[model samples]
Target: MTEQKLPAATRGPSDHTLRDQIVNAAMEYFSHYGFEKTTVSDLARSVGFSKAYIYKFFSSKQEIGEVICASCLTQITQRLNAALEEAPSATEKMQCLFQTLTVAGSELFFRERRLFDIAAAASRDRWSSAERYEAWLRETTVAILREGREAGEFERKTPLDETAAAVYLVLRPYADPVQLQAALDTAKEDASRLAALVLRSLAP
Candidate 1:
């Protein structure tokens, strides 16, 4: 009987390190050439690795895009959290969340349009990263709603899950890359107005 060979990813200098190297190289390539135009072969050549080696780490180009998209979303979430922390009240936190997301999305759409495209694809395809980000945003909004109710700033009549889901839908335009790009010109103003409307609806 012949013995089977193990994949490079399984016998490497930390799968994490190898994965990071490929992702970093891909990011650089994607930044310059855009995601749709760059192929796995291009990435493999750019990283000085065989296409098979690349495959050993990622199943498809979309998987690589997922990693990059997740990183970008993580940064936006970090900014949102920081803004929330600085806010003195739940009302302010909610406002902060909307504004921060708007600004972050706008920055990515304009400044890093290539990456934005990748994120847009991820959202459209229902990638795990996109789903996770949406979940986190909803959970965070629920927390804010709970805090507002406890502080007598918001009404408690609506069910928490329902309210949170509604809030998430309202913020979807800013969080969804494709929608965000289309609304870039009025994103900030729209976020402010929408947040105000949400606050009014939540008032005790």
Candidate 2:
């Protein structure tokens, strides 16, 4: 018999009542102690809830981390969308994508190191939040490429999917939490240079 695949882990408790209280308290605790170091028990204690009560909403500490990770990444994507909105052309949007990602990643790494740890763990463990963020990035890149090609600003020789995938691969260092930390020193210069090269290659 073929083995059945397990359902994906549930992110849990999206309401704005008790669940929000638990998550808000957990975020503060995680931000101070870091995600890997924070436990469900510790979170419960910090929030004045029993461990069992906390478990009622979240199955594990990782679940809470996933919520926090998703929130953080959502902020980055929001900023990216805003930057893209102000750009006049697809070329500017592509460039804005790189610059915004690098700046946002660096800000998280330098100013919110504890939160960054959660993102790094999410990336390392292939968490749902990270997966979703990556998918959004790829889709956004593909949209930009398609727009450029249609406008006669970019060449149409390369298949859209392949080109978008290649672009994402080049962008991974600045986008991945762990890799971004290592690339931080050169991230600005690298993003600018890479965006220029990608733009040049895309020219019709």
Candidate 3:
């Protein structure tokens, strides 16, 4: 797909300008062509630069994909936080979290499938951002479990962190993008079942 060309630099372009240009172009390329199919030359051509020039801003094309994945994950984390905050209790917050994650995964994996590919790729490579994102998920899950126990919304048979980890493991297939892709056609059914199961597990 064609994009609006960036304006010519009167002097040499700033590093930030070049980096933004490359990133924007790379995002477009990754969205339209998928990450594996896209080439640095294509990104360079889109930004009216040479491949070498593009490499000056990013070490490799995979680096650009990692940057995009990081940005997306940050946004996802923000949304998850907001969803959790909107609920009145920890149980409700956990339910909201499930719905929010399911909807987000559907959007990312079904609507913007290529972006999902990038995230999956970064996850496989154990990129720092991906690791950080996973850590955030676990921490957030544990925090919710602790809040529930403190508020008498859930039982105290197990440690909050252990229970949270177990819950996440049970829910991963429903919440994780790569794992949920095959269930896209049954989105509503899967989401309902997963939410019900988690809510039941956390019930007092």
TM for every model, in the order presented, reads 0.88, 0.88, 0.86
Better of 2 and 3 by TM-score: 2
How many pairs in model 3 have backbone atoms within 3 A of each other, for residues 3 or more apart or on separate chains, i.e. clashes?
0
C-alpha lDDT of candidate 1 relative to the true structure? 0.88
RMSD of each: 3.9, 6.4, 4.8
Give the candidate order by descending lDDT. 1, 2, 3
Worst 10 residues of 3 by lDDT: 1-10
Tell me the spans in candidate 3 whose CA falls farther than 4 Å from its real position: 1-12
> Where does candidate 2 have its weakest 10-residue lDDT segment?
1-10
Error of 2 at 47 (Å): 1.7
lDDT of 3: 0.79
Question: Over all chains combined, what TM-score does candidate 2 have?
Answer: 0.88
lDDT of 1 at 2: 24
lDDT tens readout by residue for model 1, 1-204: 122345666755676787889898888888888888889999999878899888888888998998898899999989898889999999999999999999987886579766877887888989999999999998899999999999999999999889999988898899998888887888999999999999999998
The worst-scoring run of ten residues by lDDT in candidate 1 lies at 1-10
lDDT per residue, candidate 2, 140-176, as tens digits? 9999999999999999999888899889898888889
Which regions of candidate 1 fall more than 4 Å away from where they truly are?
1-17
